[model samples]
Target chain A: MSRQRSMEKILASEFVSIGELVRLSGCRYSTLKFYTEEGMLPFKQEQENLTRRFPREETLVKIKEIQDLKKQGHSIPEIKERLAKKM
Target chain B: MKELSFAQNFSVIALNAQDSLHLTTAKKVFLRCMAAATILELYLDNGFKTEGDFLILNQEDLNSPEISRYHKAVLKTLFSKKETLSEQLPQYLKKVTKLSKKMLKEVEHAFAVALTEANALEEIPALLGCDLEYVTAGISMKEYRSNSELFSRLTESLRAETLETGPMTDEAILMLWLLRESGCIHDFFSREELKRVAERIFELQGSSSLAKQVFPITIHKTIEMGIKNFLKSKKDVMSTASGSGINFVFPVIERSQSVFIDTEKVFANKEERLRDIKARLESKGHIFTVIREGEVPLIKIDNVLYEAVPSAKLYRIPVHGVRLRKYPLSL
Candidate 1:
């Protein structure tokens, strides 16, 4: 296996599973994945398993902040940029 | 069982009474109205407008051996001999009807239906004199008059009781019951139940669909109470965006139809009242075009036309003891 791929598997092992992320974030699965795909939320993929994981602390805080911004009627792209600035 | 519109069924019973039953015109109309109310109660109890609903009004369907005999038995009670010395419907019906022993259980079921409808009517004070007594007694409802005068009193009492109990009002309870009166839906977990349903109507509706946002309750809340009191916890009077001030309408009886709109509670602004009335009427599937005749605005509900009563927001229909006059049925 490539060294970079090996590192990703180890990194993914440290991150929270999708189920745990959903519980902590209070957001739905598709929603969380969408945010992650848009690069708005931090997540990792285990190289061989193809399983996704959320970097627990940062992802939860980011999602909660995103939800607050959403309630304030911020659009998705706007939320992504705003969170990027905060990070 | 054959499918007959509510209007047709009402007309059939009225004609039956007027011609063969030896009922006076007034008595005939009343008999028709009471029969309509009983059928509507059946329709509502089964989830209004659902298939297999007990809406077939033909005598043949009422007595059809294939259908549940209990429903037939109830229909017989509605159409049977007029005079009875006994106030008790079951005893009186038992003596007169010549059904076989095999159908006795179904007859018992029909009696159960009468009991349930009577109990429901009693709970709502306003629904009192829709003439259930005469109809249940196998007599004529037209002998009595419609009881619309008690509107203000019934509304006041309902409101007082409602405000006293928040998030669980009488009207709200009735609203859910109104929405799902059919005993078909016994367990109440609105969202989850919808998910389990094959068609999934709950999700299909828009997010703000009042039906969805309002009716959800914990399973315990439902299981703790009887079906009558199931959605009492989801309290909110369902009102239209305009026209009527609140969501209370009284029944105006007809042969096979009962129409209700609180003309008395017309919205303060005439324009708003017009808007509200049109919106409410249209939402309930009535077809009418608002127009000015001789500079006076009017709403035509089928053949019986209505112009606003001068000074009040209510329609200018003659009411007898709060019941809409029989001649031109608003229904």
Candidate 2:
């Protein structure tokens, strides 16, 4: 299938790109990327181009957890450690 | 002549010069900007701070005489929530917008009262058949005409490539920021001038120690980011929000027709198509006089006035005066 068709298939499965995730979550692109890079959120990367696609449900839940932890005065490293323990 | 708070200045500008400023922004977007401006005003007063992307109230300053009871109440509401007020800037902005919706009438009243006290408010006649108070209906307008000099200065500053020399006033910068957030900046500057104006606005914003102290980025950039996200979600709503109404500013013709233009057309461009329309009409022994020409051109045929959009095949019709939408006008 073409890239467009593949993207549509992923979208049908509720897998979202970073841009779509930003729209869904109302978070800034930079903030989301930070979360992704910190391993606070999980994603699958396409080997062809390394394009990251996130499972929308899992990503949103993880984002909520991170936000709640941040509000409670946890730093990024602490939150990462906490999530690692949970995993 | 007197200084106004950021929200107050926004109200004065938005309400006073809606048409002259071409404020065709959706009411929701306007309300969001008002909310953001109000929040920024409090931020400047050191009433709130950011914890990560979330907003946290400075509890000690809740009782400060500088903060209004309405503002204090909003702060208290956020403070009482055990959880953070929002997950991020855009969500935070959306929360405050609820206050704007609730207090819009109060805001209008307060600003109107201020303008009246300043001897700056003049009540224009209400539209015919609209039996409503100026506050409720927006039928009657109260233009605050005394701030002409201030208006000129703000417009001139936007047009200039650099921030005006010396310390730019906080109120001035805040008003400019609010204008940009409300999306009225486009009406004030052409597409070419907008890029330069946007840069100058950032430079002006950067010069403000107060804003730098309050926000990680300057308040303008923070609000701009939030507004971008907000607008992205609101694109569909905004495109349809312009109401159909006859504007008193333009000559209205009783009769009109809607025409659809071919997307792929023999006309090279909009201007060429408009020229062709004029030629065709004139050749039919009808007098086609161009009144004002731009993206939407106002033309007079024989004796009737009509506004025509070049992209739309609408050759002539009595203008309903609604803003020409981005989509082609089809009937």
Candidate 2 residue-wise lDDT at B244 = 15
DockQ of 2: 0.01
lDDT of 1 by residue, B1-331 (tens): 1222222222222222122223332332223233323333344343122233122334455444543433455456544554212222222222322333333334433433433333311111111122223334544222111122222222222222222211222222332222232222322224543344313324322332332422342212133234324322221112122212222232221222222333334334455446555654554445466555332356665334555432322336542111112222232
User: After superposition, which runs of candidate 1 have C-alpha atoms over 4 Å from their true positions?
Assistant: A1-15, A71-74, A85-87, B1-261, B265-331
Give the C-alpha lDDT of model 2: 0.50
Q: Cα deviation in Å at residue A46, candidate 2?
A: 54
Docking class of 1: incorrect
Per-prediction DockQ comes to: 0.01, 0.01
Candidate 1, residue B92: CA error in Å?
A: 47
B144 Cα displacement, candidate 1 (Å)? 38
Candidate 2 residue runs with Cα over 4 Å from true position: A1-87, B18-28, B49-55, B58-61, B69-91, B98-100, B119-122, B127-146, B157-174, B199-331
